[model samples]
Target: MDVYIRSVNVGRPRPGIEPRGRDTAIDKRPVASVEVRDPGPKRGGLGSGVVEDDVVARRHHGGSRQAVYAVAREELDWWAAEVGRDLHDGVFGENLTTVGLDVDAAVVGERWRVGTALLEVSGPRIPCATFAAWMGERGWVRRFTERGRTGAYLSVVQPGRISRGDPVEVVSRPAGGLTVPEVFRGLTGDLDLARRVLDAGILDDRDHATLERKVARRTPTDH
Candidate 1:
């Protein structure tokens, strides 16, 4: 199954929305490229720029990927109603807020073709304090994590221009027993689920390494 973007909406900080402790919300604006940083303090988190392939290193980091998203068109009306407004002029922080596809089901390593662009599912985003601050809900981050509705991230496998209303189709589904939601749960310190993802063999080398490390941390000696 594949998902397609019906529209692309961007959002910036609104009036009276102060940047609370550890919160960084900027005014909504159009960007040529959206950066996805790893947010790790070490490993010079900015490993390499996906758009530029430049190795400008930094100690304090967050992963940044050029924002490309897919949403179903039919759901826009519902989303607008829930948000209490129309989706134009950028209100949602999503660079690409989409409507038709099941956004939550896309798994890592899965590839989708949008127009001439090819995107590979990379990882699930970790909700941050900024998101909570934006929503004015103190526990929003925890709640979102608990709900496990965090959106999937995609890395440009074959770079090409993408625009609103582009049709998206799944070109390939990588061999893996676990689904996208399973991977997201695993990243949130769910060891048993992580084990399932590993045993299922859906994880690539990097993911496999990370999961093995987690398993080792949980089990000091081989079982």
Candidate 2:
């Protein structure tokens, strides 16, 4: 089955997308289109082969694990009402703005054949100060987190051309794999959910090490 790619966006060349004082590239805008490619081993990172895109905060974003970010048009519509304003595609700095897709509900390890590319759901986007500033909503970070509908990040499996209006195909989904939202709570110190994220066997060793410390601080809770 195919889904609609409402818009394909990339970071426009701006003073910066990071908060006023920081360095990052989170202010993405709808591009007429873009070329998507797999960076493969030993390249820049997630945002690597994805041409014309920006990821100034290299330490925090990009890599094979987070090659692309996706947010559903439906989620943006919900936020528009919440803020009492109109929100557009790419407002959340997403690489792909899709329609007719419950992106957050997608299971981790799910593969979507978008264009000629294959992308696997890796995790969720963590709300950050850059995001807050971009949205121009005070307490936006807290509000977005509370919504628990964070967008998903994907890793390029078999990269190819992607453009606006491309249809997305759900090639396969991992049975019982962690979901994008669960990954969000997991990284946010939700103990039981964090354990589930860990058991999903998706985290890189570096991520595992960071979560290990948090896992120690929180007592186990019933799932």
Candidate 3:
């Protein structure tokens, strides 16, 4: 399917803990490269795409990379609709806003072409306090985590410049029956769903191990 960027969003760094309290005006910036790293510091390599030795994924809340998510396209729209605003209003903190892509359905290892850049769906972002703060609600993070619509994380498969209004197309679908949504649910306290994905056996080794461990921890007998 043809994908396009609906908007390019970036939050002017705020001074305090207030999520929407931005002291500076929002500005557009080109997406250098999207990344998905294991929220855990124990597993520190880039999850699915190109990574340079110097580029270390920022860690939050004690090595939880999942907390800070970059939402894409339709999912961004959904987030905006939930807050009664557009993504450009600085609600999502997304550096690159995209459209015309079913980001939730994209599985890990899948590649998407946007202009000269190619991005792969690496994993589902884990929602955090920043997300709740952005939405201006106390329980927004929990709600998102429970709902499993945290959006997909992407890694740069091909280095190229990306801008707003660029068209994106899915060039690959990796071998998997579970979608990004399924994986999100699996990670966020849903062992049954994780088990289903494991049984399907379509996930890559990394995903499979992660899902299995999560499931085993949550529902030992099933694994």
Candidate 4:
């Protein structure tokens, strides 16, 4: 499979999708192109790193560490089969829908050049309540978690424009970095895996502390 960006997506706020009637930008649609940049930090940042893309839930989404979200077309096809429906590009709220990339397997700190912009793999996207509601599938969060091919969140390195059909080149990868799925599984419930990811020192300070707490809180039965 040739690695490339299949689509670029942007979204606007829509009311009433999430519980509490909070606005959501999860229903992203394909666009011709997008300008990627760092959105600073979460909760007090400029919001979506992709220019003009809405990040309504600023407190929980979009930041320098999560400037862009990428989902593999192959994964979407697999999900379509599992859900018994056609899962289109951006259905999972991705900014870039990619082809031929095993996004879940991309190691944290791995950098890719797509079009003119440089993006670094930050981590795996964790399924949330809004995502669960959008999917409308029973036990969607748990099911998504169990499946664990949660795609990737990327941080912008060099601000530039990206478009559909742009080649995605792996420019660099850090040694000893954990793959997205490994970190996701660690943060989800596997104490051992969580510790391994933390020991790898790939996560930012905030994430590191968060994972450390999870490891400390491991139940007696968790291995």
Clashing pairs in 2: 45-63, 46-63
**Model 1, span 1-223: residue lDDT tens:** 3355544443422445534443232223343433332222224443332332222222221233323333333334544565576644223344445556666677667877765677767666566544556565557677667767556666667666555556778788876545566777986788888787777665546558978888879976756
Q: TM per model?
A: 0.65, 0.91, 0.66, 0.95
Off by over 4 Å in 3: 10-13, 18-57, 60-73, 85-90, 196-213, 220-223
RMSD per candidate (Å) reads 6.0, 3.1, 6.2, 2.3
What lDDT does the true structure give each of the candidates? 0.53, 0.82, 0.55, 0.91
In model 3, residue pairs whose N, Cα or C atoms come closer than 3 Å (at least 3 residues apart or on different chains), thus clashing, are 3-168, 73-98
- Candidate maximizing lDDT: 4
- Report the error of model 1 at residue 2, Å: 10
| lDDT for residue 13 in candidate 3, whole number 0-100 | 33
In the predicted model 4, the residue pairs found to clash are none
lDDT of 2: 0.82
Candidate 4 achieves a global lDDT of 0.91
* lDDT per residue (tens digit) for residues 52-99 in model 4: 999998877898988999999999999899999999899999999999
Cand. 1 Cα-lDDT: 0.53
Poorly placed runs, candidate 1 (over 4 Å): 1-3, 9-92, 198-214, 220-223
- Could you give candidate 2's per-residue lDDT for residues 76-129 as a string of tens digits? 999999999998888888999999999999998999998888888888888888
Q: Candidate 1: deviation at residue 87, Å? A: 7.7
Which regions in candidate 4 have their CA more than 4 angstroms from the true location? Answer: 219-223
